[model samples]
Target: LSTTTDNGTTALHFASVGDASVVLSYLTELSTLKEINQQNYYGETPLHWASFTSLAHVKILLKNGADPTIKDSKNNTPLHLAAQAGNSDVVRFLLEQKLVDANAENSCGDTALRVACEEKEL
Candidate 1:
């Protein structure tokens, strides 16, 4: 139950970052569903890392009860990170969540839509 890296990142975070779906599945079985949303030292949850990289991991995390609205230390939600990363698919999935705040502003006062627009010009 105490397994984690120096930054407090769990195996789940590594699984999400590496796109290790099978590892994620097994980890979920061993850990509680709440662990799926555990944050690291940067206050980034597994979903936050997955949001920019894998739509499949995003879906899996959400399905397993990851909270999309949980903010990081910078007050950036999963949707916020997805938008900043220009991940349209992950943004769409996060928007579909009943708890998602589309207009939620981060510490910088940037909403997901605003970030998406800015990212488009880059």
Candidate 2:
């Protein structure tokens, strides 16, 4: 009953990016591989989408065993994405993990906090 593309972009990804409620039936109240937050063609994990979009999936995915410190091919972590997106909620949640590098910079020498500040000022 799943309809994902070649790269394995599942319903979870859409739910994380759009209507989270759209996946509650499949994500919540269950513990299956459906909860597996894998990467896409862009090397972006489910946490990346969740964070990048500033969706509540931050805590949801973490609670479901998502790694907060996982990075993408561009050396950008979930915290980095969230920061760039200016989602204060996701940033605070990631900070609470105590595992993220507050000064962790990307290949472009941009840290999560730095990107957050820069994007906000823009």
Candidate 3:
């Protein structure tokens, strides 16, 4: 279950990136919290990828102990990715949870709102 790809992408990372809810559920259930929150070579957690997908993916990730506040190599949180992807529902869900730091800045010193405005039409 802890196996990863050449770049350190785990099963959980693939599942989250593909928005495979069923696989995510199974993997999260079978994996430990550390495994669920495992960072790839780029320092991104499964939750980070999930944020760029759907709210369903984000929900499953969070419910299964994926840390939303974790930063990637670029210092971007899950919320940062979600906002940049124009996923308002995912962003809203994450904001409501309050686990993520809404005020977090990435390596470029851009907040999620700044990323949102710059990346999306919002």
Candidate 4:
């Protein structure tokens, strides 16, 4: 949990992107919110990566202290990325988490609802 790549990408981030929920859960168990929510060069957290990977992964990360409301460098929340990825289940799950700000806008002033509509999932 103390290791990172040049971009500050931790094992949790990689595992989230790879949809390795088991590994993510294990790593998250050994991590604090600061470590599990560590952002990469792009300011994306494991939850951000998992938002487009797997709902199961998102759930694990969320249950393990990953913050659902963190914004990336672009100010896009996990909800935005999930919507952009057309992961309806993930988008729904994220919204249900309630910690996420559905009204939150990105750098382009686009809300998660707008992003979902753009992805044709709304």
Candidate 5:
């Protein structure tokens, strides 16, 4: 149970941040995988958090049928967050799924690829 009452965080949020296998498995049994993609107070989905951290949860959630193209309140998708975090693993993973909108811009009008270029020396 979350100590914060208003955050309304789902098991997916924590799972995406890192290795939350135990909780994730439990939640999977209780709820549908699509429910894991639901948002929290910050309007971030599980895929968003997972990609941001370059965690295996990204793959886990993906395999469980999570949508990679969903966006947050800032109009940033999981791919955008992954690029900003410079997580090559997550970026590659997202690319392989072919769900990312390469031309998709954030609230700032920058694409995820653009954000990646800004963060990486390449």
Candidate 6:
């Protein structure tokens, strides 16, 4: 159930990037919620991609137990990616999660707020 592509991207990642809500639901049903947080070669979880792709995808992943605090290879959480990508809704949603660390920094020592500021998303 943890099958992935060459880069370690699982079906959930594809579904999230494509915003295929039905496919996502089906995949979730076929697999366990733990699969929802599968990471790619770069350590980017489905949530990381979803944060910049679709809000619905993010919501589905979160509801299925995806950890918002999970970091990628660069040490950037889903919230950091969302902020860096200027996804205000994703950022806001992530901030609402109790596990989300708003002050969490990436490998570069940049927080979500700093990323948002650097990206001129403020």
Task: Tell me the tens digit of each residue's lDDT in model 2 across 56-104.
Answer: 6766777777776667888899888888877777788778768588888
Instruction: Score candidate 3 by TM-score against the native.
Output: 0.95
Model 2, residue 122: displacement in angstroms? 9.5
Estimate every model's Cα lDDT from 0 to 1.
Answer: 0.82, 0.72, 0.88, 0.87, 0.75, 0.85
Tens digits of per-residue lDDT for model 1, 1-122: 44899999988888887847877766766777668888889899889999878888887777788888889999999888888888888887777765598889989899888888888821
Lowest summed lDDT window (length 10), candidate 1: 25-34
C-alpha positional error of residue 42 in candidate 1 after TM-score superposition, expressed in Å:
1.3
User: What is the full ranking by TM-score, best candidate first?
Assistant: 3, 4, 6, 1, 5, 2
Structural similarity to truth (TM-score) of each candidate: 0.89, 0.79, 0.95, 0.93, 0.83, 0.91
The alpha-carbon deviation from the true structure for residue 17 of candidate 3, after best TM-score superposition, in angstroms, is 2.3
The stretch of ten residues in a row with the least summed lDDT in candidate 5 is 1-10
| Better by lDDT, candidate 4 or 1 | 4
TM-score of 2: 0.79
- How well is each residue in 73-111 modelled by candidate 5, as lDDT tens digits? 899999888889888888887777687877899999999
Index of the highest-lDDT prediction = 3
Flag regions of model 4 displaced more than 4 Å: none
lDDT per residue for candidate 6 within 12-58, as digits (tens), equals 88888884688877777776767877888999988899898688888
TM-score of 6: 0.91
RMSD (CA, Å), each prediction:
1.8, 2.8, 1.1, 1.3, 2.6, 1.4
Model 3 ranges off by over 4 Å: none
Model 4 RMSD in Å is: 1.3
Q: Which segments of model 5 are wrong by more than 4 Å? A: 1-5, 20-22
Backbone atom clashes (below 3 Å) for every candidate: 0, 0, 0, 0, 0, 0
